[model samples]
Target: MDRKDISEKYKWDLSFLYKDNQQWERDFERVKSLTNQIKQYKNKLGNDSETLLEVLNLQFTILRNIGNLYCFAKMKKDEDNNNSMYQGLTDRAEMLMTEVDMALSFIVPEILNISKDTMEDYLNLDQFSIYRHYLEQVMKKKPHILSASEESLLARTGEIANGPQNIYTMLNNADIKFPKVIDEEGNEVEITHGRFIPLMESKDRRVRKDTFKGLYDVYSQFKHTIASTLSTEVKKNVFYSRARKYNSSLEAALFQNDIPVKVYENLIETISSNLDPMHKYVSLRKEILGYEELHMYDLYTPIVEGIDLKIDYEEAKDTVVEALKPLGEDYINVVKKAFDSRWIDVYENKGKRSGAYSWGTYDSPPYILLNYHKTLDNMFTIAHEMGHSMHSYLSNKNQPYIYSGYSIFVAEVASTVNETLLTDYLLKNTDDIQIKKYILNHYLEQFRATVYRQTMFAEFEKIIHEKVEQGEPLTADNLSNIYKDLNIKYYGKDIFIDEEISVEWARIPHFYYNFYVYQYATGFSAAIALSQGIINGDKESRDAYIEFLSSGSSDYPINVLKKAGVDMTKKTPIEECVRLFNNSVDEMKNMMLTK
Candidate 1:
C-alpha cells in the first residue's frame, strides 16, 4: 500500500514536534546561534559550581532543541527516502549535530580537570543535584578523556569517520538490486531487501532457494566494495579505541555504557556451551520439514502447517494492548495514548525505509515507524516497537533530558520483554492445537534468531575485531572464511552450511555498528528473566520493571537491569533462555507426536 493511500490516523502526527517546516527552520537557526554561544564557556568549567551549572543548562537547552530539529528531519527523510527536500534537511541536521558535538567537546576534559573533592562539593550543592549522576559518569571516563584540543579534534572528525557507514547504507538501501526470481506461482518477481525475508518464509522450497541465491548473488558481486567499507569501519573502531586509550575496541564500546567486559565474554561463553539446544532445534526443523538435508535457505520456513495467522493493523494494536495488560493500568493507558496520539507511522510505501524502529526526542512524543504487514510476525513487531516507545515516554516524563535517552544495552530489554509477554499471552489464551503449536514455534524461532543467531554474529564480530587488532588483513576471503567456520560450528553437522551464507557477513549492516549486535542477544536473555519475574512474581516485580523503564540513563545500564531483577554480570539469564528454548522444542516434539 502506498503511503498516500493510507488513512491520516494511521500516519504519525509529526506536528506535535513542530507545526511546520518553518518552525523547524526557526529552531534550526536558534541552534546555530546557540552553538556559537557555546564557545564562550570553553575552558571555564572549573570557575565555580554555579558557572558549571550555567554552562550545563545552556548545553542542555541547545541540545534539546537540536534533538527536536534532527528527529523531525530524519523522520521526514525516513518517511520517504526519495524526497530530496527532507534528504537535504537530514543532511543539514547531521552537520549541525556534528557542529554541536564539536562545540561541546571540551566539557568532559575540562570538567575532569576539577579535583574530585571539588566535584563532590559541587554535587553537594542543591543546584547540581540533578546533574550529579551525569557529572559522575563524565568523571568515570577521566582516564580516557583526552586534552581539550585533542577531544575537539576527535569530535570534529565525526562526519569524516562516519563515511564508511554512510556509504554502506547507500549501497545496501539504495544502490544494489537483486535479480528477478520465479515465485511459487510461477510468476517472476523482482527481489528487494525488504522482500527477501518474506520470500525466505515461503513454504515452497524453490522460492526460498531462488530468493536466497538471488539476494546473495548481488552481495557477492559487490564483495570487494563491501569488504573495503567494512574494513574501514573496523579500523575506525580501532582508531577511536587507541585514541581514547582503551584496551581494545570492545572495551571502548562497552565502557561507554559502564558494562563490564565480562558481560560480553560471558554471553559468548554461555551460549557457546549451550549450543546443544540450538543443534537440537536444527534437527527438529530437519525432521519436521522432512528435508533430506536442511539448508540455510530452509531455516526460516515455518515447520508447522495449518497455522497461517494473518492479522490486520487494527487487530495488532488491540492484541498488543491485551497482551501487555500484565504491565499494569498506567502502562496500558500510556500505550493507549500512543495509539490515539498518532505516535506511530504504520504501513510501507514506495521509498519508505524498510524495518521498524522506535525513535523520538525529549521534547516530542516517542514515535515508531513500521512497514507492518498483515502477519503474526508483524503483530509481534508492533508489541516490540511499542515497548521501546513506552520506555522512551516514561523515561522522558520522569527524568531530565540528559537522562532521558537509555543506553542500547537496556534499550532492547524493554522491547524483548514485551515480545515475551505477547508470546506467553498467545500460548495461554489459544486453545486450538494448531495455534498453540504455531506460537510455540514462533517462540523457538525467536530464541534461534535473537539468541543463537545474534550470538554467532557477536562471535564473528569478536573474531574480526581481534584479527584487526592483531594487525591481520580483513580481505573478503579472510572474513568469509571466519564467518563460514562460525556458521558451521553454531548450526552443527546436521545442516548443510551453504557457501552463499559466507557472503552473508557482507550484507549485515550491524558489523558496521561497532560492538552493537551483542546487545540483542544479551537483551533477549535479560527480557526472558524479566518477563518471568513479571509473570510469576508479585506486584513488586511489575513495579520494578516500570521503574526501570522510567530510570533511563540516570544510572548505569547494568545497575538499572539489576534493579529490574536481571543480573547480567552472571550467566544465569543465558542459561534460563536456553532452558526456555529446550522446553519449547520439547513441547513442539510432543505436539508433533500426538498429531
Candidate 2:
C-alpha cells in the first residue's frame, strides 16, 4: 500500500521535527553559514577558556542543526524511498554534513596542543565546567593523536582499510549462489542468505540438512578467498592498533567508548568457566527431540509447537503498556503519549523501510519507524523500540546535546530490559500452558543466541586478532580448525560437530565488525539482571535504572551501568543470566515431561 493510504493516526507526526520542508531548508542554509563561521576558530582554541568555550558552543549549534536537517530528510525518504525529492534532500543534507565535518577538523588537534594540566585548568573555570568530560575526552586522545601529517596519511588509507569488508560484502551478498534442494512439500527451494535461517528452522530434517550443506558448499568452494578476506580484516585491525599505540586490537576497539579490556576478557573467562548450563540445555534438547544425534542444522527447529498469537496493533499497544507497568507510571504516561501523539510510524507502506527502529534528534520527539505486521514478534518489537525511544527521550530531556547520545554498549540494555520485562509479564499473567511453554522456549533461545552464541563469536575474534598481532597468518585450514574447535568446545558432546560447519565462520558478517559482538552477550546479561531487580527488587533499583537511562554519554558506559547496578567488568550479571536460562530449561523440561 502507498503511504497516502495509511491513516493519519497510524503515521508519526514529523511536524515535531519541522512543520514543512521549507523550514528544514532554512536550517540547512544556517548550518552551511555556521560551518564557515566555526572554521574561523581553527587555530584559536588555545587562546583562552572562553574562546574555546565559544567555538565549542558554536560547533554544537551547527551540529544540532545538521542533525535535525539530516534526520528529517532521511525520515522523509524512509516514508517512501521512491520519492526523488526527499532522496535529493537526504543527499544534500549528507554532503552538507561532510563539508561541515571537514570545516571543524581543527578543533581536536588544537585542543590536544594544550597540556592536560592546562586543559584541566580550563575545565575548572566555572563557565567551562559543563565541558569537563568533553575536554577530558579530547585530552585522553593525546597519546594516540599523531602529527597532522601522519594523521592525514592514516586518514587517506580509509578506503584501503575498508577493502577487506568491501570484498567480503560483494562475495557474500552479490556473487555467491546456492544450489536447489527438495524442501518439505517436495518443492525445489534454492537457498539464499535471506531464506537460509527460515529453511534451517523448517521441520523437515532433509530440507534443513540440504539447505545447510548447500550454503556451506559455496563457502567451501571459496574458502581460500573467505579465509584471505577475514585474514586481511584481522591484519588491518592489528595495523591500526599498532599505529594508534594501543596494546592490542581488542583494546583499541573497546577504548573508543572508554570500555576497559578487562570487560571483554572477563566476559570470555566467566563464560568459559561456566559452560555447564549451555551443555545442560543442549542435553535437554537432545532428550526432548528423542534424537540420538543432534546435528547443527537441527538446533533451530522448534522443540514444541507454538500458538499462533496473532495480535492486532491496537491490542499490542495495550499489552506493551500493561507489560511495562513495572517501570512506574511516569514511564507509562510517556509511552501513552507516544501512542496518542503519534510518535510512531505504524504499518508498512510501499517503499517504506523494512524492520523497525526508534530514531530522532535531540530537538525532536523520538520517532519510531515500523513496518508493523500482526505477530507476537511485532508486539515485542514495539516494546523493544519503545525502550530505545524512552532512553533517547529521557536522555535528551535531561542532558546537553553533546552528552545526550549514548554509547552502543549501553544502548542494547534498555531495549533488552524492556523485552525481558515483557517476557516476565507474559509468563506471570498467562494461564494457558501452551503460551507458557512457547514463552519459555523463546526466552531460553534468547539467552542461548544472545549470550552463549555471541560469546563464542567474540572468542573467535579474540583468537584471530591475537594470531595476527603475533605475526601469524590465518590459513584456510587453521582458521577452519580454530572455528571447528570452538564449536566442539561450545556445543559439547551431545551434538555432532559437523565437518561442514567448520566454514560457518566465513558466513558471519559480524566478524568484520571488529570485536563488536561481545556487547550482545554483555548487554543481554546486564538487562536480565536489571529487569529481575526492577521487578523483584525494591524502589531504589527502579530509580537507579531510570537514572542510567537519563545519564547517556555524561559518563562512561560502564560507570553509567554501575549506577544501573550491573558491572560488566565483573562476573555476577553473566552468572545470573545463565542461572535464569538454566532454570528456564528446567521449567520447559518439566512442562514437556508432564505433558
Candidate 3:
C-alpha cells in the first residue's frame, strides 16, 4: 500500500530465534566456551565408551547451536545488507568456523584408530547404543580417512583452495557494473543484474538486443579471470576425488551423500534421449510469438496476449495454500502455519540480497527470503521454498543428528512436486483460454530450463572437468567453444544460436558448484511421478510421500525416493516428464491455431 511497506515488507521476522543482539552475543560466547571444552576430548577419546559418547554428543549439541546462530545472523544480513549488528554477527561466525574446525580435527583420526572389530564390539555394548549413528558414518570413511597431521594440513589449505571462488564472488557480486541501454523512448536505462531481466523481457526487440549485448560486454572484459577461477574450481574437485580414492570427481561428489553413480548417469542419458520435445516446445514458442525469427532474448516474453495476473504478496500466499490441498490436511496445515507464524519474508527491502533461497537450522524453524513483484513466478517460488521448509521440518522431527541433512537428489523432489501440483491446480481451475495457455506455456518453459537446459549444463560441466583432469588447458576460447557446441545440441536446430550464449556458461554460479545442476533435471522427473500419484487422491500415495520426507538421511537417498515410489535408478520417470512436456507443447500449438 505504501512505499515503506512495499520495500520493508518483503522480509520475514527472525526475532523468534533470538530476541536481540545481547542474547546472540551470549550464545556466541557459549559456543566459543564449548569449543574450548571440546579440545579436552582430543587425546582422551579412546579411554572408554562413555567418554567417547559424551564427547561426541557435546560436539553435536555445540554444532547445532552454532548452526542456528550463524544462520540467523546470515539471514538477517541478507534481508538488509546495511545492518551493522547483523554484519558483525556474520563476521564473528566466520571466525568461529576456524575455531570449530580446530576443535573437531582430532575426532576423525581417533575414530579411525579403533579397529573395525573393536568398533563392532563397542556398538554391541548397550552403554554406547546412542552413538551407533555416529560410529556408522565415521567407519564408512575409514578407507579414506587421513592421519591427524595430514587432515589438519588439508583443512588449513581451505583458505587457499577457496580463494578463487571468493574472487569470483567479489567480482560478480560487489565490483562488476553493467552499461546503460538507450530505450525506444530516448531515455537512458542503467542496467543492473536485477534490471537485466525486465530489460530482456521488453516487448521491443531492439531493447532486448541492446540489453543482452550491454550486460555481456562487461562480462567479456573480465572473461580471462573468470575462466581461470572456474578452471581452478574444476581442478580442486579432481584433486579431492583422487586424494580420497574415488574413481572420478563425479563419484567423489556424489559420495558425500552416499548416492550411486547410476543416478547421475541415468539423468544424463535419459534427458539427452529426450531433447526433441524441448526443441518442439521452442518451435511452438516461435510460432505463438509471431516472430519471423526468435532470438535468445525473445524466450522470456509472454506468448499469450492480453492476459494479466499481477498477484501481490498476500494473494500469492493464499493461492499457494489452496493449490496444495491435494497434499492432504497435514501438509496444508503446515503451509498455513508458515503464513501465520512469519516463516517468510514477502518483499524486497533496500540493500537485500538478490534472488531467493530457503534456509533453516536444526534448532529453529525454516525461513525464506523473497523479493516479490506481482508476477506468477514469485507465486511458484513460494510453493518451491515451502516445499523445502516442510521437508526440513519433517526430516528434523524424524532423524538423528548424523542423519538430519537430506541429499539434493531428494531435495528437488519435494520442491518440484509442489510446483507441478500448483500448475495442475491452476490449469484446471481457470476457464479463460488465454490464462490457461499462459500457465501451460509457463510449465513448458520450466521443463525446458530445468530438464533440457540444465542437462546441457551438466554435460558441459562433465566435459570441462574431464578436460582439466586430463591435463588440458582451459582458456576462454576453449571453454566458450565447448559451451557453444552444447547449445547447438540442445537448441541450435530449433532457435538461432547466438555466439554470445556461449559466454553464458561463465556467468552461471552453478558451474562453481561441481556436478550440482544435474539434480535439477532428475528432481523434476521424480516430482512429476510423485505429484501425479498424490493428485489422483490415493491415500497410500499421500502417506508414502510424507513418509519419504520424514525419512531424511536415515537411509540412502535413492532408497528414500523408492519408498516414495519414484525410482531414479531407471529411466521411466524422466520419459514420463518428457511426455508431459510434449503434451503441453501440443496444447500450446492448438491454442495458437484457435486464436
Candidate 4:
C-alpha cells in the first residue's frame, strides 16, 4: 500500500493494550489518587527499618503502574501523528510525570535525612538487602544532597530550561521558509526538509549546490533566533552542573554511567590523529565522481556508476534475516518474531516523526518505525533498529525494573554491529562489481557521517558549552565561525569549505541535547571492535558481547562494555575502528582503479 492508504487504514491497533479513552481516563484518576495518598509514608520512614522498606516498595509498585499507562499512550501517539485521541493520551502522560514529581519528591531527601550512622546500621540488617543497590547510587550524591526545600526549588526550574529547544523546534519545523532553487529542468522548486536528502544525492552538481545554498539560506535568515536558543541550551547545562556540584557539565553527564572524561577525549584524539584516511577518502570521491574540484555538495552522490539495486520491502526483510545469522540462533529468532509480529510500522505516514528509533517499555515488545526507500541504506537501517529490539528483549528478560533501560553509551553498539555484518554479508555474496562498489562507498559514507561528523559535533558542543560557562555570548557570528573552522579541520585542504555551511550548526537538533552527540562516535567505534570479534568466530568474545547486551544499566556503562571486550577509556578500540575505515578506503580505491 502507498503511504496515504497506510495512514488511513493501517493505524496500529493500540486498543489491544488500553481498550479505550475511558479506560485511560479511569487509570489517570487512579494514579492521581495514589499520588495523594503518598503522604502516609512521610513521618513513618524514619521511625523503623521495616516501615522504611515498606514505603520504598510502595513507591516502586506505584511507579510501575504509572510507567505502563504512560508507555501505552505515548506509543499510540507515535504510530499516528495526527490522531488527537492519542495526542490527548501523550499530554495526559506528561501530567502523570508532574503527578509523579510531586508524589516522589519527599522520598529521596528524606532518605538522605536519615543519619549516615543510622543508614550504616540499616544496611547491616538482613531486611535492607533489597534496597542496598539503590542506596549506593544515592550515596554517590551524598555531598550534594540538599534539604527538601532546595530539591523542590531545583525541580521547579526544570521546565524553564526547556523553553529554548521548544522555541527552536517551532521556528525550524513550522515557521522557517526556504527560497526556490532552479532544478535541472529549468523549473523553480522550493526546498523542504524531506527534499534536502534526495537533492543532496542528485547526480547533477548544480542541483546539489542549489539545494545546499537554498536550505542554508533559510537558516541564515533567522540566525540570531537559532543562536539564542542554542545559547540557552548550553547555559542550561552549565547551570545544572554547577548547581549539582559537578566540576564541569561534561563530567556531570558522563558520570551518570561512570564514564571517564578520557573516553570523550580519546574519540577526538583518535579521529584527529587519523585525519589522513578521511582526507584520502574525500580525495578518492573526487576521483570517482570525475570532479575537477570536490565541493561539499558533491559528497553525497553515489561514487559508483550505474547499477541501482532496488530490493523491495519483502526482499529487504528476507535479506536482513539471512545477513544477521552471525548473531546466533536465539538473536535471529527474536528478529524473526519482530518481522512476523507487525512490530514495525513499515512506511512513512503524514506528520509521523521523520527518521527511525527503537522504542519499548518493560511491559511491551520492542517496536520500530521506518521510511524504507528500497535502497541498501534503508536495509541497513532495518538491521540497525532490529539490533536495538533484540537487545531490549534480552535485557528485559534478564534484569530487574531498575536495570531494564540501557545507557546511550552502549546503545548504538548493537545497531552498528548489525550494519557491519549486513555490509560484509552483501559484499561477500554479490558478484556484481557495480553493486560491490556501491556497498564499499556506502560503508565509507557511514564512517564519514557517524564517526567523523559526530566527533566534530562533539568538539563543537564542548567549545560552545565552555564559552557559555565562562559567561561569553554565543551569538550568530560566534557559532557560525566555530562551525566553519571545525569543518576545515575535518575536511582539510582536500575539499572546499564554503561560507554557507556555517549555518549548518544551527539546524542540528542534537545540540539541544546536552553532551549527547559524542556517544555516536564512541558507539560506532565499540561496535566495529565487537563485530570483528563476532565474525572471527571467537567464542569468548561472542559470549562477552552477548553479556554486554543483557546488561542494561545494572552497572556503569564503561564496565558493561568492558565485559563486552571493548574498553572505551583507552585509545585502542577507537584507533582500531579508524584503521578499519582506512582499510575499507584502500579496498574501494583498488576497486575503482580496476573499473
Taking all chains together, each candidate's TM-score versus the true structure is 0.98, 0.85, 0.93, 0.92
Report lDDT (CA) for all predictions: 0.90, 0.85, 0.81, 0.81
Q: Compare the candidates by lDDT and give the number of the best one.
A: 1
Give candidate 1's TM-score. 0.98
| CA error at residue 240 for candidate 3, angstroms | 2.0
For residues 437-516, write the lDDT of model 2, one tens digit per residue: 87787778788888999999999999999999888889999999999999889889999999999999989888998888
Local error of candidate 3 at 362, Å? 1.3
- What is model 3's C-alpha RMSD? 2.5
Candidate 1 per-residue lDDT over residues 1-595, each given as its tens digit: 5678989998999999999999999999999999999899998989988889988999999889988998999899888877889989988998999999999998889999999999998999998988999998898898899999999999988888889987887777667878999888888988876677778888899999999999998899999899999999999999999999999999999999999999999999999999998999899899999989999999988888976677989998999999999999999998999999899999887777778899999988899998887877889999999999999999999998999999999889999999999998898897898888888888888999999999999999888888999999899999889999999999998899999999999989889888999999999999988888787746888999999999989989999998888899999988988998888888888898664
TM-score of 4: 0.92
**Candidate 2 worst ten-residue window by lDDT:** 147-156
User: Ranking under lDDT, best-scoring first?
Assistant: 1, 2, 3, 4
Q: Which run of 10 residues does model 1 get worst, by summed lDDT?
A: 190-199
User: Between which residue pairs do clashes occur in model 4?
Assistant: none
Residue-pair clash count for candidate 1: 0
User: Which residue pairs show collisions in model 1?
Assistant: none
Tens digits of lDDT, candidate 3, 164-244: 665686577556778889876778987765556656756678998999988887888888989999988998989988877
RMSD in angstroms between candidate 2 and the native structure over all alpha carbons: 4.0
RMSD of 4: 2.7
Each prediction's RMSD to truth: 1.4, 4.0, 2.5, 2.7
Runs in model 1 deviating more than 4 A are none
Report the C-alpha lDDT of model 4 over 383-413, residue by residue, as the tens digit: 9998898888899988877678899888888
